[model samples]
Target: MTTILHIDSSARPGRSGEQAHGSHTRRLTARFIERYRQFDSRTEVIYRDVGAVPPSPVTGGWVHAAFTPPAAREPWMVEALAQSDALVDEVLAADIIVAGVPMYNFGPPAQFKAWLDNIVRVGRTFGFDRSRAGEPYWPLLADAGKQLVILSSRGDYGYGPGQRLEGINHVEGSVRSVFRYLGVTHAYDAAVEYDEFGDERLLRSLADAESATDRIAQVIASVRTRRHAA
Candidate 1:
């Protein structure tokens, strides 16, 4: 069975139209998973609500613990790396990751950023070897065939390729770049824009984004079916 890791990082806990001041990203991701379940009833999902309880930020102790050799680590080192190890395990087990990360100040919120920090652990998601002169660092997840789906929202608009504000938009770009570094096979995204305006444009963007999420679910399901048949 396929496993999906669903993470919602929006500060808002409710979905748009479901509650006052709700989150669009959350709505999109929920829809994606809900629809995908129709195609594969046996699919398993691991949900993580980072928006409600953000992961702890990476501290100096975490860095030292992560960099140290696992066999030589002290008790304190193991304790320091505990949360990161669990987070990395979740990513390693999933075939797909569906993240709801609303743009905050042109990038991801502090909670989501902290989650990223916790998962991108040395000797886990990535490997480092000082002795390997030409390639000291490498993505340990390479050839893992993982996929990341980023459901996002923007306060304004124009954050796609060659769009008016593409150069400045860091939300999806940063998230995608991080997963790529970890060797995800594909990174997909859908976003609702004009949130600050709250005009007809916002409504239109929301509808389009919701539809995109459904389509993404279908695409992934199709791939699974083909693989099963093969």
Candidate 2:
């Protein structure tokens, strides 16, 4: 069975047309998962709603706890890292991670950022050794086969690679960088733009994004099925 870690980070509780000022990213991720499941029946989805209940922001205590060796950590440190440990376990247990993150300002919502902070822990998701000849930091999960699919939304246009506003667009770039560091080497993204202007352009963009999501799901399902059979 394929295990998918489904994460929704949009503050909006519902999908567009389903709720007032609903999240476009939520709609895209829902469609992506639904379509993906049609291709494979034996699938397990672990849902996490960071929007409604976000992970606690990393504090000095969290830092100390994450950096300390597991066996050496004190009781307080262990308590501090409990949530992060759980989050990392969920990521490690999944073969695929599908996240719905919306652009706030130029980057992801603070809620999603907190979730990233929780999971990207040293000695957990990454490794550090002072007695190394080369670089000491390495991704621990690099050998683990995992894929990341990000569905995002934006209010403005021109955020694609080489686009006019690409330099300022940190939404997908930030998430991809974080996941890449966590050893999610394979990644896919599909987004909807022109959200502020809910006009014909928005409608067209949403439609296009929906099609893109469907195609991505099909492609991923094919590759996963082949791998499973192999």
Candidate 3:
């Protein structure tokens, strides 16, 4: 069975129109999940709400403990890395990952940053190889054969290619960079823009995003079906 890791980083709940508190990205992700389930009932989903219960930031203690060999680490060191280990395990076990992230202040929220810090361990997601001449850093999670789908919500428009705010849009860029470092090259993005200007523009953007997300779900389902048959 295909295992999907669904992560929501919006500080809201429920689908759109259910409550005014719900974020656009959360509603998009919900629609994606609903359509995905309809395509494949046997798929397994593991959900994590980082915005509601953010992971602890990586501190000095965490850095030291993560670098230390597991066999030589003290009890406290082991405890410090427990969450990181678990998060890494979840990623390693998943075939697909769906993430909901909202653009806040031109970037992702601190809650999403904390979750990224926990999962990107030195010896876990990536590694350093001094054996090379100059470029020694290599990704351990590379070739893990996984796909990532990102759902982003932005208050303003013109964040796409050749747009007015393209250069300043950090939400999609940051997410792609981190996942690329972890060896995930096949990543897709679906975004809802003009949220602050809630009207016909917002409705049109949401519709476009929803269509993109549905297409992605269909593609993933087809891929999983082929993999299962093989």
Q: Count the backbone clashes (under 3 Å) in each candidate.
A: 0, 0, 0
Encode model 2's per-residue lDDT on 22-118: one tens digit a residue: 9999999999889999998888999999999999999999999888888999999999999988899999999889999998999999999999999
Each prediction's whole-model lDDT (CA): 0.91, 0.92, 0.89
Expressed as tens digits, the lDDT of each residue in 101-156 for candidate 1 is 99998899999999999999888898888899898888978888788999999999
Provide the lDDT at 2 for model 3. Answer: 74
In candidate 2, which residue pairs get closer than 3 Å at backbone N, Cα or C atoms, i.e. clash? none
TM-score result, candidate 1: 0.97
Question: What range of 10 consecutive residues in model 2 has the weakest lDDT sum?
Answer: 123-132
**Model 2 compared with the native: what TM-score?**
0.98
Error of 3 at 127 (Å): 1.8
User: 23-80 in candidate 3: lDDT tens per residue?
Assistant: 8888888888899989998778888889889989999999999988778999999999
Models sorted by lDDT, best on top: 2, 1, 3
Q: Can you tell me which runs of candidate 3 are displaced by over 4 Å?
A: 131-134
TM-score of each: 0.97, 0.98, 0.95
